[model samples]
Every structure is written in C-alpha cells, then in structure tokens.
Target: MGRGRGGEREREERKRREEEEREEEEEERREKEERREKEERREREKRERERRGGETGGEEEKRKREREKRRRDRRRGGEEEEREREEERRRDRRRDRRKREEEERQEERRKREREYKRRGERGEREEEREK
Candidate 1:
C-alpha cells in the first residue's frame, strides 16, 4: 500500500534474481571445465597409444597375454622358493634325528662295557677264594 514497502519488495526481488543468475553462470562454467578435461584426457591417451606404435586389437591382445604370462612366471617362482624352503626344513629334521640316534647307540655301548667289567671282577674274586 505504501511506496516505501513497494520499493523494499522490488529490491528483494532484484537480489533474488541476481543470486539465481550467478548460480546458473557458475554451473555452466563448471560443465565447460569438465568437458575440456575429458577431451584432454582422451587426446593424451590417443597420443600414448600412437607413441607405442599403434596398439591395434591384435597388439593389445598380445600385450595382455604377455602380462598374464609374466604373472604366471612370478607365481611359479614363488612356489619354487616355497618348495625349496620345505625341503631344507625336512633335511634339518632328518639330520637332528640321526644325531639323536647316534647318541643313544653310544650310551648303550658304554653301559655294556661297564657290565662286562663288573662280571670279570666277580669271576677273579671267585677263583682266588677257591685256591
């Protein structure tokens, strides 16, 4: 109803329109930047492929196969190493068992020698008493 009130409403409407326009412009700028970046990435990849002597479908497949082969070779190498380690452990265990058996044999021989010495002494004492 009053001029002052109308003027205030008009100013608020203008501010709202300006904010919307700013937001739209910012959105357009962001979209353009994204498109440019995507194009640049494509160009870079194309150049790389060209530099590598034109990776056609056959070349790509060959490279893929080579990569797979390398991976298999590496896995095989790891398995071989694991097998070698297992073999070494087994050898150590066998050596320890052999050593223990040898020690037991030596102890048994000593016990037999002690028993023979005691029997010889007893026989000599018996012979002297009979004389």
Candidate 2:
C-alpha cells in the first residue's frame, strides 16, 4: 500500500508538469500569432501608403479631386438617363391611352350601326305582312 501511494504521487506530479508545459506552449503560440498579425498589419499599411503615392502631397490631393469629379459626373449621367427613361414611359402611356380611346369609339359606332340595321329589317318584315 505504501508503494501504491508513492506511485500515485509520482503520477500526479507528472500530470502537473505536463499541464504546465501545455500552458507554456499555448502562451508561446499566442505570442507568435500576435507578432505575425502586427507584421502583417504593418505590411498592409505600407502597401496602402505606396498605393497612395507614398506621401500625402499635392499629387495625391489632385488625384482625389479627380476621383470625386468622376464620381459626380457618373452620378449626373445616371440621373439624366433615368429622366429620359421616365419621359419615354410617360409618352408610351399617353399613346396607349389615346389608342384605347379610339378603339372604344370605333366599337360604339359598330354597335350603333348593327342596332340600326336590325330595326330596318324588322320594319320591312312588318310592311310585307300588311301587304
């Protein structure tokens, strides 16, 4: 029983040491990840600066202004196109309304003609019967 106790104590000590080692390894991994992230951030910033002409100067300012102008022009062009489309739609609607009204008038005239012909036929039949 004494030997068993000693064995149990040794196993517990070993487990503790293993846990500490794992924690240290995890801390090291976190440190490395942080370092890598910082390096990557610096690189991205440097690239951005280079893309923006490496300095905030008159040239960069000019480019920014030109970009803004182009954006505004595009927006204006889009608005003009939308207005033209709306006008076309309005014209189409007016034309369609006129066409429908014309069709309705023609239909009414046809109905009146048909009614008149029917009455004339009935009158002729009555006259023949009287004769």
Candidate 3:
C-alpha cells in the first residue's frame, strides 16, 4: 500500500535470492572437487595396471610358450603329460607303501617289548611263590 512497505518487501526478496545463489555456488564447488578426486583415482589405477602388465610380460611369454608346446604335443598325439602324471602317482604309491612297512615294523617291536615285560613279571611272581 505504501512505497516504504513495497521497498522493504523488495529488499527481503533480494536477500533471499542472494542466499540461494550462494548455496548453489557452494554446491557447484563441491561437485567440481568430487569430479577431480574421481579422475585422479582413475588415473592412478590406470597407471598401476600398466605397471603390473609390464611386469607380467615375461610370465605371459612363458605361459605362451608352454601353451604352444602343449599344442604341438597334442598335434603329435604324444602322451608325455599323461606318462608324467602316471609316474608321479607310482612314486606316491611307493612312498606310501614304504611308510606303511616302517609303521608295521615299529608296531611289531612294541608288541615284543610288551610280551617280554609280561614274561618278566610272571617270572618274578613264580620266584616269590617258590620262596
């Protein structure tokens, strides 16, 4: 209704708009910082992967050679891998058999010791009876 009242309302609206603008600017600054941090992380990860790949080149070449050798063997219908596997199994079985034999021998020795102790106890009792 009055010029002074209208002026006062205008000043309040301007202040509210200025506060909203400040908040929007702050939000934009935060978003920019987040984007920069994400980009840095991605770059670091990419560099790390490149370094690892370079380090693994020798291992990759070794694996490639092994694969090629296996392919060649397959083409020739060679049983080299199977023969090696069987040999390993045979060695394992021989080792297991030896272990079992050793255990049995130790068990027999323990049995003999127990039997001798029993005989000695009985002989002592018989002597006491004779006394």
The sequence of per-residue lDDT tens digits that candidate 3 reaches over residues 30-107 is 657866976896698578667766775687766875796588568535445654665576567557656865875797
The residue ranges of model 3 lying beyond 4 angstroms of the native Cα positions read 1-72, 75-78
Off by over 4 Å in 2: 1-66
Each model's backbone clash number: 0, 0, 0
State the lDDT of candidate 1 residue by residue for 91-119, as single tens digits: 67557656865875797689689889999
Better of 2 and 3 by lDDT: 2
RMSD (Å) per prediction = 38.2, 35.6, 37.4
Best by TM-score: 1
Question: Of the pair 1 and 3, which is ahead by TM-score?
Answer: 1
TM-score of 3: 0.42
Off by over 4 Å in 1: 1-57
Q: Write the per-residue lDDT of candidate 2 for residues 1-131, one digit (tens) a residue.
A: 66797678659856865765686576568657866976896688578657767556787677876797688689769866875775576567557656865875797699789989999999999999999
lDDT against the true structure, each candidate:
0.72, 0.73, 0.71
> After best superposition, candidate 3 residue 84: deviation in angstroms?
1.1
Ranking by lDDT: 2, 1, 3
